[model samples]
Target chain A: MESTYLFLTTVTIQSSMAVLFATLGEIVTEKSGILNLGVEGMMLMGAMSSFAASLYFKNPWLGVTCGLITGAFFALIHAFFTIGLKANQVICGLSLTIFGMGLSSFLGRFLIGKTGTRFLIWHVPILNKIPLVGPILFNQTPLVYLSYIFVPLIWVLLYKTNIGLSLRAVGENPTAADVTGISVVRYRYLATIFGGMMAGLGGSYLSLFYTPGWKENMTAGQGWIAIAMVIFSTWNPFRAVIGSLMFGGINALQYYFQASGITIIPNYILMMLPYIFTLVVLFLINQTEGAKRKLGAPASLGVAFEREL
Target chain B: MIEIKVKQRIAYPKITKFFTPFFALFFALLFGAGLFKWVGVDPLKAYKIMLSGAFGNFYNFSEVIVRGIPLILSGLSVGLAAKMMLWNIGCEGQIVMGGVGATAIALFASPYLPNYLVIPAMIFSGFIAGALWIFIPAIFKAKWNVSEIISTLMLNYIAIIWMEHLYFGPWRDPEGRGFPGSAIFPDAAWFPRYLGTRIHLGIFIVFIVTILIYILLNFTKLGYEIKVIGESELAARYANIKVTRNIFIVLMISGGIAGLAGVGEVAGVYHRLQQGLSSGYGYAGIIVAWLGRLNPWGILSVGIIFAGFMVGGDALQLNLQLPSSLSLVLEGALLFLVLAGEILPKYKISISWKKLSKS
Candidate 1:
């Protein structure tokens, strides 16, 4: 029972970091009132690029940096589209996603079955002696600890600072914010690029620490799960962490359940849980009368701000 | 630092419309060539091979049509919904369900029923199944104002999983050889072909769907109402058009048509219900719809062009050892460039005079 507990805990946190990073990134972007639906695309680009880069550079950290750039690069196109061209955000985002998927698949062709330099495991020096919690909580990769710090750091950044307030103001009421001297375009671009970069890191995590081998669409629906996590958390960075862990637990539970030899429920049906859970939660939150969703959603989330020059 | 301003065009020259698509195509090809170069393949050689493979001979044209048949249905599904401003990215899900429906009819009812009844029944069941798949998302969008984007996207994953559950469990072939696919469909259920080629009766079906969509969008009140709704939902309500009902109808039409693509694939192409039934036709349909600008004839043309990409991509795999995913890259580049180019005709750009003062 103790072993099972440790197994589930370690797996949960490991899986959670990828989604946690993505959700946090999206939260920041949405806070600035830019809705980016290209998380999956950006993540895929990040995953493939980082894996390939790590393979070439022989350093997982450098590969992760490359992923950050690649993800931001994809988001740059999206930024140019919605911010510069004033194109419909939904269409441009969808295009960005498809572009990412295609590019990743095309580029990842030779990288299949290839492993890369991975984030090394570490245990807290003195904390490693603690009972059940020690192995689960204190013993983890560096990135996992970084993800733990991000929750509070982002929470404070989003809630405590003037920049956060201005970002929120821009997303909530761009015209009013514009009158008050905040540049909506700049804030949105920065927020979106940051979001894209985090999503890339999320993908980099998948390639470098979580799985450490490249395959076609290795990120699968995790990017979507991260997006769903953003909504499920009601745009709170801390809440987003909890949501990611929950979804991550569910993902890890699938493997656990399979290994335990449960015969009644099949694998494919188990696979449906995450998506169905997302749908149910989205429906519940978006019922229009839900107070939580109302408070969390940016006022002008997907609306294009056409500045009068 | 020069500032740019956009002015909405009141009226555009007819010639500009004709040139925009060609320009988009030219740029898309250029972008694709650059991608090829990055992948260590010669751009000119790859393009030459691709063009030849896609349009080399009568056999290649037939293959293109075979591949295009589903894309037309998938494109129309999206094109119709896009007209009503309903973003139905669930065409992939709808297609999968349609395949299930058609496969059930083909496998179960084909032997029991007359040949004439079976084919039509499969088609009808496929449409109904597809429509049913999108029903919940439609209601949520119409009544509750839920974002159909995530809902529809989620449904795609669910549908694929559901399909996998069946094939891997109950639907797995038991008799002939312990395969993953269902039993080969009965002869009576097969889509008829012409001139000993793989091109099925879907050729005629494609033409019919294209004509119907064109007429529906161009000559019908529903089409006009869809246009109004897309342009402005408040304006549509003011015009006394039933926004909720139109929303539902649009979804049903979109889902039903997309399902037919599944039917064409199963009854025509694969001849069985199995894994890999949808090769991203659902998602690719969106690209086709956008590429075609929601025009029926344009959808048909774009469908064929995309189909050519698929066929040529296969040829690339066989001959040059290039990955089939190159086609996906090409498609993405085309969609991106086309989307960029689409703005030019509608809006005019001008240089701001007092750029220095603004800074």
Candidate 2:
């Protein structure tokens, strides 16, 4: 019984790490004033690319790299349209998503019926031997540990550094940032691309480790969930960790409950818990004035910036 | 060449406005051709197959119009909502609920009512369901300033799950032999088909709705209010337009129109509630709305064009051994190009010597 509980807990943590990584990555992108609806497309592409590369190269790390690169490639297209051509951000983002979905599905049709190379969890010798906290905290796949590390790292990059300051400045008031000699467009382009890469890596983790296989539309609407996580976290990476984990936990609980035959609650309602939770969070956050002030987004987040004549 | 620099400063004639979209379309086609070529297919042959497939036979051509009906309604929904500066992304959810409401009436209520009464009731129910689905987010935005984009999008998942639950559980047809869907509606509940084709009276309804929306938007006071609000909320408020009420009204209308699209699909085409009923018509409507520049008449033209692509895509899959997703690729490319086209008209490009040298 204890072993079963430990195994279930491990699965939940792993799944949560995957969601947390993706959501945290999206939070950074939204903070930079670029709303990337293409995360779903990016994740799909990443999943396929990583799975394909891992099968070919026989190395999961290489697969992760391929996934990140694939995601960055799509983001480049988004950046060109929104940053270079000065298109509507939301429309451009959605187009990227549609394009990504179509392209990935087309690719996957050919790739269907093929099994992906599986990955196993590796642990450090000393860290693996440590007591209760160490197993929970330290003993995870390298990708999972990387996700935990990214939270504080992203926080520092978004709040403490000069580049971070400029990113926020550009998001809030691009004209002001441009006047101060910062390249607002350039920063936004880079930030969006970086965020896209992170989202891609997060997706690759699904195929490479989480489920260790490929399925059509497998990421499902998790990409949208990641987008909602940004709002739930109030645009903070640290809080996004908690929000995404809770969502991941709810998702995992549905599966466990279904398997356990505790059938009082309908599975569909349980499946919908994350989205319901997102709506509730939006309500709560919007209601609180203090939360609104602290978590309020940049003034010019979605507005397209053009230099004044 | 005659030196044309005779004291007059000539302004470029906004040629970019017309040329940019052409260029973007050209490049998109080029990219698509490259993709096809990489797969060892001749680009021209593929295009020929796609075009001929969509319009090859009389039967195929009529199918395009049948598909265009829903596209027009959903396009009108997005176009109308955009005029009020509301991004109604939850059209997918609204469409689903619309189908649910319309189907419910067709299954349960149509038997008890007269034919004339039943048809209108289904449509009215669909509109109400759609409006109610979107009402929550609209109200949240109006009262608490929550982001409608997020709310509407999140609601889409809820709507889809709800549909799946109904189809897979309680509403599952007793005679379906384990298939996940409701039973077909009675013939009285179905829309009237056109002469010797699957095309239904819904096409006529779309045409009428298009005309009505056009008149409403261009000639009515409510239309003027929407235009004013879209241009500037502060200015509209100062002009006593009652921005909140206008927002709510526009969103409800938008959701209702979107719902009508779902009703048309369920009652006219499928005659039964199936999982594949939507096939992304709602999202495609967004592209149609933008391509039409939010003009109702424009939506009609763009809607037909979009439906042609869908039919052509189906053809490409069957005949050319190409992926059907090619249509989506084309649509995405068209959206990118059209938006870029809109932007080019507002700005003039100049080649400055200093900037050129710096580069």
Candidate 3:
């Protein structure tokens, strides 16, 4: 039973890393009042680029960096269109996703079925000796530990910093932020780029550590789940842990069921649960009138901001 | 310092609006050539291959039409919904369920129904099933003001999983050596096809549906409400439009149309609900709808062009050994370019080296 618990908990953390990174990134982006719906696309490009880079360079760290760069680069196109040209955020984001998926598939085609430098499990010295929690947390890849650092860092950056204040101000009311001598464009761009980098890092985690190696459409709806997680967390990085863990738990359960060859719950139904669960969460979040206000989206989430002359 | 000033256009030239999509295509092809060059393929040669592959012969052109049938239906589905400012990205799922729905009729009900009635029943059931598939998302959007984008997208994965379950589990054909698909759909369920070509009755069906939607969106009171609601939901409420009911109705119709695309795939093309039923036609519909500017007639033209792209992309794979995903790259690039170009007619942009002081 303890072994099973360790297995589930460790696998849960492993699965949660990607979503956690992406959700945290999106939280920052949305906080700055830009709704980028291209997380899936950005993540795909990140994963593809990371995998390809790792294979070429023979270093996993380089792959991780490339993934983040690719994600930010994709987000840059979105920024230029939505932020610079003032294009429709939703449509542009969709295009970004399509672009990412296509580009990744095309570029990574050669990398299919090939292995690359992957992050292996590294046990920390004394930390690995801790009873239950250590084995579950300490005995994992570098990316899992990196995720632990980011969750708190993002929380502090969001809720306890001047930069976070300006981001929130811009999202809540761009006009107000502009009057206070804040460059809404600059803050929004930075936040969006930062968000993209995080999503890229998440993608790297998938390719360099979690599943390891490049595969077409490897992110496989986790990017979308991260979007749902943003809402699930109510834009709080700290709360994002809960949302990611919930998703990771679902993934771990699916893995467990398949591994045990359990017929009690069909494999397909288990696969469907994550999506259905996301829908249900969205429904519940919006169902209550009070909850809608309390856990509302950023006031100007999808709206473009143009300063008045 | 340089400053770029953008001012909203009071009136734009009609020619710019008419030529924007073409220009977007030109830019996308230009970028596509750059991608080809990057991948060690000759740009001009690649273009020549793609063009010839798509339209070199009557047979190829017919195949393009066969492909365009689904594109048009899904495109129309997306375009109609977008008219009311709704994004029906779940058209993919709707298409899958539509196949399942039609398959149910073809596999089970065909024996009881007369030969003439089977195809019609499959079409009807497919449409209804697609609508039902989207029912949850529509309700969430209408009642709770939830983002239909996420809800609809989530349902897409669910629908695909369910379809996979059906084919891989209970619906698996036993007689055909344990094949992972249902028994062949009876001849009664087979859609009427043109001689010596894969083209089916879907052409006429799509035409009728397009015209019906065009008339409904233009000449009708509900059309006016949809327009007003799209412009401003507050204004729609002030004008006594039943906003919630309209949302539900429009989404159901949109989903139903997308489902018909699935029917075409199963009844008109595959003749069985199996793998390759959805080849990203639903997602491709988004590009068509946007490229067509959400106009039914425009969607028809764009649908054909996109189908040509798909065929050409396959040709690239066959001839150059390039990934067919290159076509998707072109489609995505086209969408991005079109979106960037949209700023042109809407706003007049001017750049100056010196920053303006005060006014």
- Give me the candidate number with maximum TM-score: 3
CA shift of A105, model 3, Å: 0.3
lDDT of 1 by residue, B1-359 (tens): 77788788889988888788789889988988888888788989998888889899999888999999998889989989998777889899999999999999988888889889998999999999999999889988888777787888889999988987777777777774767788889899999989888999778878998999888888999988989998999999999999999998889888999888889889998898888888789889998998888889989999999999999999888878998878887788887777777667778889866646554
Q: Which stretches in model 1 have alpha-carbon errors above 4 Å?
A: A128-132, A288-293, B1-14, B175-178, B344-359
Q: What tens-digit string does per-residue lDDT give for candidate 2 at A1-309?
A: 766566566667787765676777777777778777888878888888888888889888899999999988888888888877778788887888777777777776766766666667767678766776566666678887787678899999999999889888898889999999999888888888887898788779988888777776778777877877787788788888888778767776787888888877789998778788888878887887455656757777777777875
Give the TM-score of chain A, superposed on the true chain A, for all candidates in the order listed: 0.96, 0.93, 0.98
| CAPRI-style docking class of model 2 based on DockQ | medium
A117-196, model 3: which lDDT tens digit per residue?
Answer: 99889999899889978888899998888878888888888778998788899999999999999999998888889889
**Cα lDDT, model 2, residue A223:** 80
Can you tell me the DockQ of model 3?
0.82
Give each model a TM-score: 0.95, 0.93, 0.97
- The DockQ values of the predictions, listed in order, are 0.64, 0.64, 0.82
Candidate 3 residue B121 Cα shift, in angstroms, is 0.5
Q: What is the interface RMSD of candidate 1, in Å?
A: 1.4
* TM-score for the A chain of candidate 3: 0.98
Clashing pairs in 3: none
Where does model 1 sit among the CAPRI classes? medium
Q: How well does chain B match by TM-score in each candidate?
A: 0.92, 0.91, 0.95
